[model samples]
Target: MAFTRRGILLGMGAAGGLIAAWALTPRQFAPPLHPGEGEYAFDAWLKIGKDGVVSVAVPDLEMGQGITTLIPQIVAMELGADWRQMAVEPAPVSGAYGNPVLAARWSQLWLPMLSGLADAPDGLLTRRMAENDAFVVTADGTSLAAHELAARAAAAGARAVLAQAAAAKWGVEWEECEAQDGFILHGRKRLPFAALLDAAADYSPPDPPVLRAMAPQERAADMPPGAQLHFVRLDLPSKVDGSHTFASDVRLPDMVHAAIRHGPIGAVRLGTFDAARAKGMPGFIKTVAGPHWLAAVADNWWSAEQALARIAPQFAVGDRADSKAIGAALRKALRSGAADRVATVGDPDTWLKSKFDHVALYTIAPALHAGVETASATARFENGRLELWAASQAPQALRLAAAAALDLAPGDVTFYPVAAGGSFDARLDSDHALEAALIAKDVGRPVQLTWSRWQEHLAGRPRAPSQAVLSARTAPDGSLVALGLRLAMPSSTRELGGRLFDQRSGKDALFLQSSSDRLAGEGLIPPYGIANLKIEHVPVEIGLPTTRMRGNSHAIGAFLVETFIDELAQRARREPLSYRMTMLAGDQRLAACLQRAATLAQWGGGGAGSGQGLACWKMQLDDRIGRIAVVASARRDDRGLRVDTLTAVVDIGRIVNVDIARQQIEGGLLFGMGLASGSSTSYAGGLPTTSRLGMLGLPQLADCPEVLVDFIEAGGEPFDPGELGAVVAPPAIANALFSAGSVRLHHLPLTAEQA
Candidate 1:
């Protein structure tokens, strides 16, 4: 019989406190099996119990991507273990679990930039790079590849360790035994892994274990036979049964409730009213204030919120307060800013001057993550031992930040992972976690900090608004000639106050004290072999608080680039699909994806009054690159353009779970469509007015059309299926509108008036 241990479920009253202490404490936080107590340990990730149960811990957060299920599924496949007998949980914060892909990328980019290490020998620099292993996690859906590799390696290591233990127990040569499905096999008989558990006490793992290779025969044998055998979503049953634990479900003994009422984003401190009246409110506890924000703690959340409503705070406004002026500034910068050229193959100045081919300029407004669950955290500071339970995508980063805020060593802090309803970039900037820590430290008790919807809207960093001006020249014979694109946007790394080293002064400084220009553009520029091509970025500093969104810079840039490509095809009187195929000369992967989508959607053969449009995007995130294409069908009339159907084709290299991959594509498409057609968030007086759901005009069930997704398995390596839909949906919608005889959409959030 298979047995599973459920976590603590906090209900109410004194009994709940006792349950929390018994089941949710860190003493129970270790892996289900103890290393030295009748268990075989295989590194930090895998532990096999004497009872024949296998438990694995993964570092990836479970934010509805089904990572908890996927990680174990990968390990079980490699270990030849019974899937039904495995248990998985979140791993503790440690360097051993760091994502290799992210670590490699970060080391390559920032290691040599150190002041004293800039001139270091290549071998020493390489050694230093290998020592750093802190991987930054964001909700942008790019960590899948690295996590897959890491999980597989961990499983392989466990298999090797088990082989060694089995050899010793049977008194045979190591090569004389083969382990499969939790059993060690000798010539004609097999011994259960549990029988040799005691021998594992003296087993020492090999220096470098060989990982199973991805040969063609191995690939065919490993194909998941059904959903049950695949990387199935394991959290679904608990969620459906209403037994799953979210961050808000956590409760501790004598924990007070906290509510924060902070100034708007980028707002400077000015003044606040006296808290004398709030102190008199029912269930009032105490008030905590930071440099630019204040919080109230009470016996209940309602009392804390009620206490906050009685006070009025004032602050100095920021520079991007005027919505109209910010738009004007973006347009002006795109038109006249001195360009910092990124790539140029030949002289495009002379070609553009002599040709009257085609030019399109587009701009996108700012957008919010707009998560269902508002940001919240629970923290406690007791005698220099700080503990926090946060819905953080990057828990280690949050732990480090909290340690820094409390003037405590990192070892003094422990972060407990919790489930989040959603997190595009909300968890990336851990302001709420920091605030909770500070408030708990001051009050000398545990505090659960929550952000009101209004506060979440005002204080949260938004996707940076962007603008682009693309110009192209074509021959009269419909042949390509030259292309030029100038992209401009606020630097996200700089705006978020990233740490940097000043080369001139030999000192470290934040982005505020250094240049804002960055080489990090989100989407891969087009790979077409166009003559006289010039692509550049004009970095601008708009005094607005900005962070990465779902697609980051790629969403806006892809919108402009894809839409312009469609316009060029129209000007040349050629079919959009055919034009793209010609341009994708050597990119077989992208071409195949585009062709597959077109075939699935029946491109150029839509019924009367129905028009079709196609768009494709190639994304390079970390060490993985994948391509996605979308073909849309729509109709235009007095009711405006309505997208009736959408078909998407993806080449993500390798797929672990087809169901989960399809779901990600569907969700991302819906999210992008909501931003493209309905959203209208504006800023005024240094504050966003769309604080609630109704005002944001997000897309509803009625706005959704039929969506079909297809995946192409190239089968070598796997990339994430998270952000491709976000990159392909917006431009596909815009191109569909044009194909259906609507006016060109040069701006995002295609309003009815514009149509």
Candidate 2:
């Protein structure tokens, strides 16, 4: 691949010459995993103990996604180890665990102009950059895509050596030995793995270790409800027993608790605070002031919080962000802002120049993550080195950010990864980590900083608000001929990239937001076999900063496209399912999902008063495609909109762990239901009107709709199922509402405009 001159210049501008040179150069680093006294390291992904225990190194953060169990299961299956003897440890930042898949997907953010040249997982530039930066970020559902094959390979090598040891003892060729259930078998003889550990450590694995005929898979039919699980989740027991260590659960000797207060959005500065008011308060320690915020350190978290409240620091805002203003900005941009044509299929300009059969507009409010736990981190700064314990999607970036904030080398910061209570991609930012580091340094000891609920809303970045207008031209048969979509939203993805990769402030990132970002327009291209289609993006700069949410742009794009297609079906007086099926001739997997979902949901043709709606989506990253179809049953009543059931059929190619995949899809559906019904807030005076989690209108247990999910068995690469349900639920619910009551709600948090 050739790098463009413009791309090179942009890379140099964003990352200095030294950084750019390092990114392009191939370098090696020590393995991230270290074995214990009785353990033998097998490459970087796994270690085997003398007692026959297999410890897997997980490079991704575990936020209730079962990745800790999933990765370890992969190793156990490949190495022929028993599930009971499997273990997991968080891998440290190192070149050995680099995630080239994520690096290539985020090339535009890190490499800018050279993104096109390095946009493949196997691209030389992508690998070099990811390895050099130790960029093993846990986002975009790329964990399996990045680590699966490598991890399997390592486990296979380990299996080969173990077999060689057992073969020598049995006086037979290693090739004739079979490993099963943590034991090596030859004819009627069997030897446990523990008996061969010493000898296995000394044997050399084959150049290309032999692999099993098939990858690990669990059929949905075999794992019926209440059936015995083939591979139980490793973290479930600890989590249920309250022993799992989350960020807030970390404790250190002599650790002081700190509560922070951040200024409202826009240009702001710390004004005044009556610290004297907290002087007599019990357990109140000194107050630390930053450029734009204040922190109170005390013996306990509650005391620190009370002290901050008593101090009541004030801030002077320069350009406050308001919900009304944000909405107006999106509208203005959609109406007259300069547009960048991001994607095109054929001659859409000529086809769309004339009259169109149908046109519809959609709007989405700023959505909050509303994670169970707010931003929290424990940091210790001593002996000119900093130690941080936090749950971060981008660990390397967080380490670099803390290092830069403290004016220390990257090596000086030691980052300890911890489980997040719940992230939903909200842990991608390291603002809280940096703040904790600053407070720890200021207090000259270990400090745990926990943002109050109000502070979390004030400091946390929400998903970008958006507006889109979709127009379609139909043929004589009422099939789509040409389609055009104009979306107006901030270059939120680019802004997030700037903050994550370039360590730019939110303000600086907005100022440097690019005119066009392919990531921002992700999923805008319709998956249908449309002949002429054009997608354009109009970048708007709302004063409020926005970060990535669970589904990224797909959440918004799928809502827009799917709903618009539903409307077109209604306009043409056609059946919604068949209409979509007619257009999905090129994607059989997606068509199969739709058929399965409709059958599972007992879809009633989505007719008037049927309370049924259907939506489908396909997420493509390189050659991997995760497809899903949702059939939502909903209705409006005196109380409010009530969703009764959500049935989904997913085709993620192969199933690694059926139980985990089902849990993810179910969790994502509920999460999306929360976003569709609530999880939105209005801003006034630069402060969010909704502060507490309860105010976010999140669905409680009673509000959760019954969910049904079925997986389609297909032969291909496995895809992550984490974000598929999230991308399809909103549109399906909206279409259902239309079918039930002829109520066409265009905005997210469907009640945003209605309320």
Candidate 3:
């Protein structure tokens, strides 16, 4: 059963003292995965079929992240199964698959009063909360961290039971039999898994199954450029052949298309509309109105969109949001606002009281996700039950929201997860799912709701605008002695937590915004060894609700810290690479990455007119830390600024799938490049001035730079490489522009003029 805060609180009132004890106790849930007729269920993570195919259950979303393949690959390698026999299915929401890592990281959102007690993955409170809520969210790059050990243990157990069955048939010791290549072998006597599945079902595996000597790792030498891979991605062929199913690809009998128009940002309600204008339009069914939006249903998507346009529904806006107001609020807060210390080392207040060597202000405009496919969902309501097919980063949240919108019990809603074309964390919001359910209920049939590109920007929340004043006291050698940062922005992460965990509206959540949010200040602490450093958050509400984007706060924090350091190096007449290396004495991994990246890019000392710049970053979640260094080459031609190449060296410790990791780094660089070039929007009277993707100045194929990526073979715990490249690219490119054109750009996208 799904747990809601209100329901839990009410239960606490009735159960009284027992509720507190019960809340801390661990909860057990039935396995979310069920085997088909010919399959034998081994555990919650995997099942073996009579045909010898091993299907692994993945609890994360597959949004071009290769997670569907990565998890199964882990199971295959650990179970000693052949790669050719591996398959994957999306696991349903259940306590068995709760993501304790993410739940612990986001403890403040769900357990705000006692977040400190539940801030670790293995903590009793964190496990209980995660399992009770089925918090299987697929954000923050925690897929492997949360599920790796569990999946490995499950696979090891399955392998042991299978070996037991094979040994029993051969009258040999189970420990002597080895399972490999989809078969159990003992002195050349072999038996396929299919032959022992029936007997294995009755056997119990060892309490602590023996694991393999090593986890899955691919040497960099084994995957040279253009070399064939041993285990190819299973989803690539279907995607290339156009047979893969995304949320929008789902179709149901007697389904109608819907196009919605949401009011601009602020407190708004749906107003009157000219329904007569679209009454006689071809295939136009009817218009449905909700509190804050309007939708038109028709036989086709194009027709529905046209109907919405023809009707031109209006909305009553109150306290509209404006870009000028947002900027002014940030500036005001930076000048005189209540500051809460996020991170501190030594005594920064005392150091900042004296004169600092350097100070600079950096600004980042609000950016959009600009995903390839807009928000789309297919929902059908009938027989007092709702069936939803959608691609979501938080599927349980989406299901709960849909059920609440329909005033039905949570058990009445069934969700089917599907692939997203590209989310960039956009799928975390469940507004579209709730809208689809409402539309389906109104139409009394299966309804497919798709927001047009225009409507997407109108309704979608953008990344919060930020302004930071960075002050640093440096030594004669350009090494930083102390640093202080005062960042002004909304408590965006807390706002998201309110919406995702508390099911509160955006405006309501913003109303409860606090003056401090550590999640928003992530990555602000430099990896270098600075004696005295302080980072303070000055939260400000700009009458605009912001949500989490791909890189989270690291993208903004890295740009601020790295660029300021580069500027300090230039002012002190020191080489950027050597200057940074001097401060990184404690972090050998980061220093190695910097050295390798500089070598790969052919370091030129970043002399004026050399067209090369350097930046590095580290992302840490719990014990896992991912480090990356980037060297960007850029120059301004007669046309405009052109980035010619980006060379990056990443150290994400152990590599599960080298090819996938490389793809993530390459994609992240380009994604970051896109943000650096454009992807920002300005609000005027609650409407974004930039409406379409073409207007966002996204990098086209011809604009893509030559990306070179390499990984360090440091065998340790694996880290997600998805956000590291993005976090470092903007500052690297900005520093490159400084070298190429002798201009200091303090704003993101390196605009010609500061806003």
TM-score of each: 0.87, 0.95, 0.96
Model 3 misplaced regions, further than 4 Å: 1-27
Evaluation by lDDT, superior candidate among 1 and 3? 3
lDDT of each: 0.68, 0.85, 0.85
Estimate, for each residue in 77-187, the C-alpha lDDT of model 3 and write its tens digit: 989899999998899987777888999888878888888998988877888777788888999999998888778777877788789989998899999999898998999
Could you give the candidate ranking by TM-score, starting with the highest? 3, 2, 1
Native-to-model Cα distance after best TM-score fit, residue 643 in candidate 1, in Å: 3.6
Model 2, residue 355: distance off in Å is 2.0
Model 2, 418: alpha-carbon shift in Å? 0.3
lDDT of 1 by residue, 303-407 (tens): 999888886555554543546766776777788876666677677888876665788777777888888778889999998989998887777667777888899
Lowest summed lDDT over 10 consecutive residues: which window, candidate 1?
Answer: 16-25
Can you write out model 2's per-residue Cα lDDT over 375-460, one digit (the tens) per residue?
Answer: 99999999999999999999999999999999999999999999998998889998999999999999998999999888888899
lDDT of 1: 0.68
Poorest stretch of ten by lDDT in candidate 3:
4-13
